[model samples]
Target: MRAISMQEFGGPEVLRIADVPIPQPRGAHHLLNVSRAGVNYADVHVRGNTYLAPVTLPYIPGNEVVGTTPDGQRFVGLTPGGGYAEQALVHRRVAWPVPDDISDDQAVALALQGQSAWHLLFTAAGLRAGERVVIPAAAGGVGSLAVQLAKRAGATVIALASTEQKRHVARDLGADAVVDSTADDLTDRIREAARGPVQVALEMTGGKVLQATLAALAPRGRLVVYGYASGEAATVVTHALMEKSLTVSGFWLPHLYGDRGALPTSMEELFQAVRDGDLKPIVGKIYPLGEASVAHSRLAARDHIGKLALDVTR
Candidate 1:
């Protein structure tokens, strides 16, 4: 099997495609003939050595994929390092069966992002119907799914993106309103467009955007911080929280799956939504397995509108 490996972490250039031996599934683990691999910000972080977990050197970097197990069962789940290869292994407990209607590319794109968005809205934030929610980076993988899920939950969604093209993508995904975060007065614009305080804010970009999101939340409203795309993490001012009685929470998908034991349920709901046409992943670009480095560069540049995937079987 061919895989992309990083002997050392630094930049996109470090990712090198090389032929490697296929891995075998051990007890309770299943081997997958990877069809498509999901590319995430976490992969970029791992490549740059900024991941929360220390990734050993000379390792593959993808965390999730959609593929068939040794028994010919189709599923999706975390693969840690070897997902960038043609074949990988995932834990049986973490893997969920993919619907027949969902394509391999869509399955790969949605597995992690869909699960994360569902947990963030339904589980972590406890978003209620008729609530107003704001999602930053609304055209990205998680944000796109967040828009669809929030709308399905009956919440009015405000999507924030950097480009008009991205805003259009968000609008097509069913966002109630779109805000261009690159504009000078982003918070004011969001408030003006929303007509009131946002009840829930799904913040991915940290730094100034996170601060603005906190300011825009309604009293006692929740702000869920999931990622720091600005290359720097944001710190909340505790005193400000007291004044508004605001709730600030951080959501990490792995932690949510590990702590609440809701991974299977979330995956089931997301895949069902996909099957029913209520939810769909926006696949931005597809790259062959050998061009994994280029995919990483595209993700790092923030050039794609939605999820990028590696077509391993192609």
Candidate 2:
């Protein structure tokens, strides 16, 4: 099997191509002949050892795959890792059969990033209709989906993106308003866009961005912290949160994967949304499996939009 493996923790340079034996499924896992592998910020963190969970050396760094089993059942679902390979293993219970109308690459886009967007908005944030929500990195994979999903849920979405192009993308995805993410007046912009304090916020990048988003939230508003893509964790002031009556929570999809009911439910709704033409996935570049390093470089640079994927067949 051709796969990308990293032996050290550092930059994108650490990911290198290697010929390793195909992974075999055990227990509830099913082996898939990987067609495409979803690339995510989490993969970058794993490669650099900065993820919430630690990674061992000589690890394969992809957690989402879309492919077919030996039995010819096409599946698009979460893998425990090893997705940047010609063959990988996915838990049968967590994996779902691909819709006949969807492509492998498109299915790969929805598997992880799509689910992340779904859970981040509804499950973690407990989003409700008529609420005003701020989604940081609104042009990225999960953010883009969040924007569309939020709008579909009848929420007013204030999107923040770093560039004009990304801001335009967010607006096209049905955000009520879009702001320059790099603006020094981010908090002011968010509040103004929503016409006042926001009811909810999806925080991905930390550090200064976290402070700005927190400042934009209304009393009793909830904030979901999912990722620190900026490589800086937030230093929250407990007093400020207490005074504002704000709540902070964290969301990791794997935790819900254990909730058999949650996984199938989320996956079904996510797929149905796409099938009904109510949700559209944003897919960026698709790199060859051997060029996994290149994909990481693009993701780390934050110069790309939507989800990146590895075409294992290449």
Most accurate candidate by TM-score: 2
Give the lowest summed-lDDT range of ten residues in model 2. Answer: 21-30
Note the Cα lDDT for every prediction shown.
0.86, 0.89
| Cα TM-score per model | 0.97, 0.98
Worst 10 residues of 1 by lDDT: 252-261
Off by over 4 Å in 2: none
Instruction: List ranges where model 1 is wrong by over 4 Å.
Output: 259-261
lDDT of 2 by residue, 117-152 (tens): 889989989999999999988889899988988988
What number of clashing residue pairs does each candidate have, in the order they appear? 0, 0
Task: Write candidate 1's Cα lDDT for 1-314 as tens digits.
Answer: 88988899888889888888788558978788988899899999999999877898889989898888768889887866788988888987777788777888778776788888998998888999999999988888999999998998899999999889999999999999999987767778888778989898988888888888788888898998888989777888899999999999888877754543688878778877887788988878999888888998988888688889898886
lDDT of 1 at 35: 86
